[model samples]
Target chain A: MKQKNKKVNYSKWGYIFILPFFLTFFIFSFIPLVDTIRYSFFQYFRSGLKWIGPNFVGLENYKSLLQSDMLRYAGNTFILWIIGFVPQIVISLLLASWFVDARLKIKGQQFFKVVIYMPNLIMASAFAMLFFALFSLKGPINSILISWGVITETTPIDFMGTALGTRSLVGVMNFLMWFGNTTIMLMAAIMGISPDIFEASEIDGCNSFQRFFRITLPLIRPILAYTLITSIIGGLQMFDVPQILTNGAGSPNRTSYTLIMFLNDHLKSKNYGMAGALSVYLFVVSGILCYITYKITNDDDPDGSKAAARKRKKMERRMK
Target chain B: MESKGYNRFRVIFAHVLLIILSFLCLFFFYILIVNATRPHAEIQKGFSILPGGYLVTNFKNMISDGTYPIVSGVINSIIVAGCSAALCTYFSALTAYGLYAYDFKLKKVAFTFIMAILVMPTQVTAMGFLRLITKMNMDDTLFPLIIPSIASPAVFYFMYSYLQSSLPLSLVEAARIDGSREFRTFNQIVLPIMKPAMAVQAIFTFVGSWNNYFVPALVLETKSKMTVPVIIALLRGADYMNRDMGKMYMMIATAILPIIVVYLFLSKYIIAGVALGGVKG
Candidate 1:
């Protein structure tokens, strides 16, 4: 009885330890998300100083959002994401590989790393303002174009006034901010590969390309998967940059309008149900993306996963 | 060791590529610094190639002007960010300690529950969170900002793994044998072991909170209570304020300096082992 009591005390500490996280998460995150799910079914209306009810309105919010250009805004987000993410993946992958190359003799590698990640630490709103200024009419970019004879001073390109220009600016910002993070994560993954493996590959007369494809790529698949999924998630939720850039109007033909912007618009109009529905859609889409990432990345460990499963089963059997 | 001529060229080419990449990383920073020092008129005249002498004026104007309240914004940001970081690190580490050290009935359930929500973008929960905060009278207050960070699943996972990889049960046992209470064991023995992780995650949380705009934009309503990002947005959004381009640049430059300074001092520790447990969800 005393031993059991001691064990009970042991488990009590576990609960005590995790209580704060669960409590805070429940109050702030879980309840809110559950409430969002519930709110998706009801319409919100304000009543003077007191905000009124989430009266049940069934699937109307989802139907209305589907009937509108909300999907178009999603498309805009996808376009921005693609343009931004592709270069981000490619460039960061190259940098990651380069940084790890002992033969490269890259000087001040630490400085490059520190500088690259500096952007990530700064606020996105600050980036938006900085880019807005840089790309504004008669901004430095215009001056550079003029000097380079890319366009005459009289014909300085209006970057913010055009969809492609603004999208590209957004894309550039995403690339700049994220490329470093991806590089760091990927570099860590590459370095995690045992040096003996590299020595073994070299002993087999494997060329650099062979080493990358046969060893590095296979080894870093997990981090690659992680970065890809997170990048997609961040891209899908691209809000502050475009919103601030176009002053939240999604100007230049609403090209900057994203799902978050659309959702915010609904929220502004007190269309709480619609905002909830949009958030649910985002939630579902993210879940699906995560599933796909798991599928692809898990497949990379074809043998190891199965072997681990077997080991786990064996351990379970032994315990039983 | 002597290398072939072609291999030597490859090395040189790699250096050149690195230099180019580094330039790409540093380009905007250079532009921002130059723009911040230049006069408003010079900035408006299509960018001065060189730095002007208006940085002090721009800063002075920002300080004197109460409309933007750049100074208060910085203080509010520091408070919110600092509190969030402290709360996030300490509570997350505690939570991680719980999950890591114990074998409880709900351990797997708790783990899965938190991990499932880890990837759920905060935006999905924003509407409901704002409503709750408003109902609780936390809107326009920093409480919502600082409190939610306690449930940081990313920090939790990082610390959990850090503890798992480094901590030994025997250490805890030894402490218990030494007559230390459970809390004291954690505070004295476990905490010291988790210090490196706490520091790393503390910085991450700080930077994340400092730069976070979405939730703060929604929750923080008042002018004095606003964070740096919120203020920057308002100032940039105001059309007339646009004329003080140098001040705007200076504001941004100033906002990023503290973080850059922290990073410069801690870069060696930060970049190493940050992703040692990289495969986390």
Candidate 2:
């Protein structure tokens, strides 16, 4: 009984230590999330003062979201995600593989790592301005392209105006912004593999490429899956680059407008109901995509599963 | 002998490819710095590798007339980032200590809640959060920008994992037996040992807050209250055609300076933190 009391006292102190986070999380995160969903179903009126009253719209906002221009915005977001995320992962893996290769024998590899990582720290607004300077019709890139006679005076690249043009712009920006960070993460995962595996592969006369494909890729599959899912989720929700570069209207016929941008506009226009519905839509879509990605990438290790089952059976025997 | 020759050729090819890619990466940054120095006309006309003499003039123009409230924005950015980092570090550390020390029935549930919120993008609650701020009469203030970020679940998740690995329960028990209160034990005992984790969290929180554009843009409408990123956005928009090119370059340079300075100082912490955070997440 005395020991029980002491244990309770210890737990009480633990609770006391954690109370601040719980208080703040409840007030800031959980409450706002609940309020967001709740207010989506109501009519928010602002005649005298803002008031949220239950109107039982019965999925009116969600229904309207489906029929609204949001579908177009969603399509744009999907395109951006593919352009941004797919190439990002590929480039990252390629770079990581190259960095790990023995033949490169690169000096100051850490210096290169730092240089690539620096861009990710820059503000999106600054990056946008930098790109605007670089990609403008009269900018140096165009001048260089023209000087090389790649295009005649009659033809100029309108990088920020056309669908393909904006996609390329954002794609490049996303790649530059993300590739370094992804490379570092992948490098860490690669480094985690036991050196004995490499020795074994070499003993078997496996070449570097073959060893990487067979041993390295398979061993780091979980990490790759993790990176892919997070990148997809982040890419789908991209806003700052498009918002800043396109002046908040999503550039050249809204070709660059992501779903988040669309949602922001709805909120700014005081269509809170629609904004809430859109948020819910993004949440659901991202959740579903994450699920699908997890399912597709999941690998079943037969030996590992059998080992786990044997360990469980042994534990049960000890308990008995 | 033929295979040896082939291997040598492959090695050379790999090094050449790597060198080219490295140069490509360096070229973009070179463009940024060169553009910062050159006159807008020269920049528009063609690439110039050497530094020009327009940097001081640009700096003066940017300080005098640029849309960004450069000095005040810097101060506001520092305050917001500094306060948010301190608050987030303390709260997250405290939560992590509690969760790890106790064997409560709701431990799994509480942890799941933290993980769930970590993945939920702030955009999902932006509208409601905005309304909540307006209702509290806190709109357009730096308070809204700083206070809400203090409850970052990502930081809590980091702290949780860090505490599990680095902290032991014996220290807490010893402090308790010495008649130290829970808060005192945490402040005096736990915090000192958690410096590595704290440094990483602080750097991440500071850089994140410093680079944040969306929440600040939405919440702070007043020019005086604008954060650095928001000010940079405004400068980019304030007459792109007839804009003071010198001032524009200066604003861009100023906007990037703080982050670069901080990153230079805290890069070691940043890298370690990123590595650790990546492991658990």
Number of the predicted model whose lDDT against the real structure is largest: 1
Where does model 1 exceed 4 Å of error? Answer: A1-8, A46-53, A290-320, B1-3, B240-242, B277-281
Residue by residue across A58-117, what tens digits does model 1's lDDT show? 998889889999889999999988988998888788788878878776778888888777
Measured against the native two-chain assembly using Cα atoms, what DockQ does each of the candidate structures obtain, in the order listed? 0.60, 0.51
Q: List iRMS (one decimal) for every candidate.
A: 2.7, 3.1
Considering summed lDDT, which 10 consecutive residues are worst modelled in model 1 chain B? Answer: B272-281
- Cα displacement (angstroms), candidate 1, residue A128, comes to 1.1
For candidate 1, give the lDDT of residue B109: 92
Q: State the lDDT of candidate 1 residue by residue for B131-181, as single tens digits.
A: 898899888998999988889887887888888889998898788888998
lDDT of each: 0.83, 0.76
Model 1, residue A3: distance off in Å is 7.8
**TM-score per candidate, in order?**
0.93, 0.90
Query: What are the clashing pairs of model 1?
Result: none
Lowest-sum lDDT 10-residue window in model 2 chain B: B238-247
Residue B269 lDDT (model 2): 64
